[model samples]
Target: MSDRAEKQTGGLAAVAGAAKQAPGRGLPPVHLWHPEHCGDIDIIIRADGVWMHEGSPIGRAELVRLFSTVLRKDPDGYHLVTPVEKLKIKVEDLPFRAVTLERDDGRLRFTTDVGDTVEAGADHPIVVETDPVTGEPAPRLHVRGDLWARIVRSLFYELVETATVEGGRLVVRSDGEFFALGPVGAGVE
Candidate 1:
């Protein structure tokens, strides 16, 4: 197929079609996250109409279409998580890193500057949290500083930390007896 005539179909559509007919490269679930040295990133791409993570079950038809985009062109339609409109990260740990990723099977490949190459189940869930909620019109998120990556990271950490905590004083102690320390005016004789 020549470029001139191939332009008739949209670039993505054309590629998706081609991949459907090609052999298997073993489509892996694309994982995106921030690096440990940097901030946290817990974002989910809802715009793609489909929410499939690493190891997610997909019919061959869907896999072909997705692979076509990756095989044909750069990752533009890939689903990535973010906080509201900006990337989120904790401010206290400013000037850090954001590890974004894309994965398949149990293997993962780093897509950004901050992260590591490791194996993670494809079904790993990223809890999407929003302050203003998804409805109405308010931006559904929170972040530190003005960086989009910061926002993304912060939101991710916040979600994970909160989920791990059962009651919620802050830290999730493994065994310590959480004794109440005296305050400034508690009067400890």
Candidate 2:
């Protein structure tokens, strides 16, 4: 490997080791870490939520989770911040994908690809937007802080299955809150 490649690997390894030592009590305080910008890394989160590094898929789920812990979205763009360095990463769409969902009582719980679980409620609301050009539905859920997870196609279908019309809007109730999926005429009425 080149010297730069080696440095990147060593830096990532150090971060992973530190993450392993820390208690698995929620996400790390990445917002507080003001490390020096180390420029952009060859990391890309594809639209489908696959994490790619150096034009290859990052095969280790643990590493991805570790990286996700440090992810931050600044006014400029998305970045992965460690104590020592902050590396920018590209995201074609949202950084996470809510691949699995479970209905808990009147609430809905979502599990992201990176293993973060979020419940839809006041703190975490589900929002659906229509693509102005393509007219396709783009559904997303707030995971934590400013991070969000895009609801996958299958999970969105499941959510639609339980949808109801309220106030002329297609809506679903989760966490005792009613979330409008779309207008009643969007085929959900």
Candidate 3:
């Protein structure tokens, strides 16, 4: 392999090893690591939440989940970080997809494709942006430290079903915070 490719392969193994060595059952403390940038890897997180490495889909779900635990977002880009090395990756959109949602006692909890569960509230607020050209609403929930999950179409539909009209907008309440889905009567077209 070329030098750069070899470095990337070695870096991937290092990162996977570091992630597996995480002390407990929770995610690695990637936020606290200030490792030197090891350069970019040919990993791409597609808009649909598929993790691709070297042009093929990363077929191992467990490996993807493990890698997700070490992901960190910096001002420059998204990275997989270890205490010793940090390598950037490309994200076509948000890094995760909110695949399922549940409501309990007025609070909303969402599960991402990578197995992250986050409750929507002040800290993990939900936001919607309208496409300038299509005017369709794109909703997302903050997952963690600069990472957000695109709320999937089905979950967005569920949110709409539970939304109430407030101030001419359709809004849903989760953990005492209200999030606007869209303006009332806004067509999806």
Query: Local distance difference test, per candidate?
Result: 0.26, 0.85, 0.91
Candidate 2: lDDT of 32?
81
Stretches off by above 4 angstroms in model 1 are 1-13, 28-127, 131-189
- Per-residue lDDT of 21-67 in model 3, one digit per residue for the tens? 95466888889999899899999999999999999999999899999
RMSD vs true structure, all candidates: 15.6, 1.7, 1.5
TM-score of 1: 0.24
Off by over 4 Å in 3: none
- Relative to the true structure, candidate 2 reaches a TM of 0.92
- Candidate number that wins on lDDT, 1 or 2: 2
Q: What clash pairs does model 2 have?
A: 107-175
lDDT of 1 by residue, 31-146 (tens): 33222221122212222222222224234545433532221111222222221111221122212122443434433222212221222222321212223443221111111112
Return the TM-score for each candidate structure: 0.24, 0.92, 0.95
Which window of 10 residues has the lowest lDDT sum in candidate 1?
Answer: 136-145
| Deviation (Å) of 188 in candidate 2 | 5.0
Better of 2 and 3 by lDDT: 3
Worst 10 residues of 2 by lDDT: 14-23
Q: How many clashes show up in model 1? A: 32
User: Model 3's lDDT to the true fold?
Assistant: 0.91
